[model samples]
Target chain A: MMVSQRPSEVSTSAHERVYRTLRSRIMYGEIAPGQALTLRGIGREFEVSMTPARESVRRLVAEGALFLSSSGRVSTPELSNERIEELAALRALIEVELASRALPRAHMALIDRLQGINMTVAEMISKRDAVGYIRANLEFHRALYLRAQAPAMLAMAETVWLQMGPTMRALYGRLRRTEPPRNHKLIIAALKAGDEPGLRLAVRSDVTQGLRMLAG
Target chain B: MMVSQRPSEVSTSAHERVYRTLRSRIMYGEIAPGQALTLRGIGREFEVSMTPARESVRRLVAEGALFLSSSGRVSTPELSNERIEELAALRALIEVELASRALPRAHMALIDRLQGINMTVAEMISKRDAVGYIRANLEFHRALYLRAQAPAMLAMAETVWLQMGPTMRALYGRLRRTEPPRNHKLIIAALKAGDEPGLRLAVRSDVTQGLRMLAG
Candidate 1:
């Protein structure tokens, strides 16, 4: 890869590159809460300068994906029990609407894609791969939301996911359910039947079920 | 004021000062959509260096409070019609939950405070003060969400407000409605009567009404 060729292939600014990488990691439960990070560390890992690293960190902090302590240490957020419950409620609220909006636009092809992702999710669960399971689970939701044509709403929902990443890893690790996601099937069925109320309920149930154990 | 004395009272980092000032302006509808800003201009206005201004602008851009063009110009976002509809759906979904959560904790004092804010909203409408009306309307919602004890969810709701600030001004300016926010009155009544379902409906209606007008 020549240096000139590399620049054209990757035109994004350094900080944006860093931000996207970190965002995905946090969104998919790859990072644990209280995991401290530093600009120098990130710069080294990503082969970028300290300035870009700091900018990326600042963006993440603003989005609640990362937390900054009084002493200025950066880490993934360890949400309080109340905060977790609140985020869960938000997921239920926002994602259900997203599903409903997508319902009208949802086609057989979209449903097929979601069903395929559900299968991947089931495989991840069987393997006890927490991160893979979380990734696939969100993919299912994201695929549905992409059809909703509501970027602003979808962005807000993704922020909730980013904030919940660390906590979700912990939750999924502790839950011993052998069954794959029950409500996902309901969600798919509701979508197929054009059942709006049923779709909303399925989404609400799926969104809340993962966090309910932590609340208990 | 002596330069030395000035730097101490405003001891916040330059970027933070810039971020907070711009955040309030955007959140309160002081800035309109498509209002272009430059890093140099922001630094000059705030009496800071370009670095801080750039940092602040980056944070805002990440939060969807501002937009960044391919040419690197910054401006308040002018949301698309589809985006506005999505945001409206988001508000209805999240706010209904917030109102429901707050219902258990919403006592007489909170209800009284909300009523007071409602009065201000009415006065603003009569005066045709678009900014004042928006501020008071948000205050009413914020007061209720505060009681919900769900900071994370409330924060997400407020972000939606911040993003909608400019459009809200446009929406209010176009509508010649002299009637006080009807749904707000219902919200107050729902709170007074301790009707959970009624509270949810009222809040949903109030959140979605203005956006629906534009969406139509």
Candidate 2:
């Protein structure tokens, strides 16, 4: 959080630290999509060796978070509309399952927590704090999905979120900080009511309806 | 298909060549799961510098094909039962979508080709040709999903297959080879009948049923 010459050396090894730092930057939309990132540049920025930077970039590349040209130039991946649609379908399939499983487990306390985060996200949106809003909004969904106890599915869903990071920044910037959706409140109500279909529909819309609205 | 004396130096960048060679080997079950691999050892085996081998291993780490230890050591990931179930769920979601999409678009030739490959797969099993059987089995599935025209989803699915590679080898090797499951035939039949539900059921059974049998 401090503005210092040194990046935070977090609870990980150098390569992993570099990976997480770069990944957080990309996922939080600090880095623009299609901006080329050379290993040397990344290494210098992160105060890591070239090997660590390459290792970080290579990991991102295989996950489709980053793209490497045939000549080995690296940049954040740019998605076509069709690709985004497929990814959305994937999110729907996975997140709906996550939410459905989570519904039975979600408690009033959990709902309270999500509501708290949602309110914070709304405040961030009002303040035009892009990164804060993204973090809070994602935290709300993640807290909900945690109840699924499906680690792999959660991981896959987060990968989709990671890919959508830059696009999300662009989309959010276009909007004048609209209120956090009314549907999230509906989602909480459905969960509280033990309404499986209602929860499923609500969560599905929460995950995807925004994209449809954006695409429109 | 020719083996290289310089395994990781076949025209492409050394790192990429290393990545592909290791990836195909891992996916084809040539490497045993939970087997430790050192960067130096991989470099020596592939007759490349450590940089290239490190890059390849990093990519595999990204794909979840390999796992890196906290100490920076690399090994094939050892999956628990819960992890396998999660992956199976993911496979079901993706493959069902793929099979469904492939339905109306699957041409007669593609169906015929899949059937032909299935027959070869059966012959390979009867002959106790694990390698050949694996190859043919992958071909059969790839042929079917190729009709879906969703390369990104297919790639993600294949990445899952690659991660399960060594474990699959152990599983298949432990069990005596049998006649290909009846569902294999049923799948082809459903495809020919243009039966969407039948095709979905067949694909689901072809996938989940085998794992269920294994679990039992």
Q: What is the TM-score of each candidate against the true structure?
A: 0.93, 0.92
- Prediction 2 TM-score vs. true: 0.92
lDDT of each: 0.89, 0.81
- Model 2's CAPRI class is medium
Give the clashing residue pairs of candidate 1, or none.
none
Q: What lDDT is reached at residue A209 by model 1?
A: 92
Scored by lDDT, the top model is: 1
**What is residue B125's positional error in candidate 1, in angstroms?**
2.2
DockQ of predicted candidate 1: 0.78
DockQ of 2: 0.75
Question: Candidate 1 versus the native: TM-score?
Answer: 0.93
Residue by residue across A49-85, what tens digits does model 2's lDDT show? 6877888888888777788897889988777777777
* lDDT digits (tens) for residues A138-189 of candidate 1: 9999999999888888888898999999889988988788798899999999
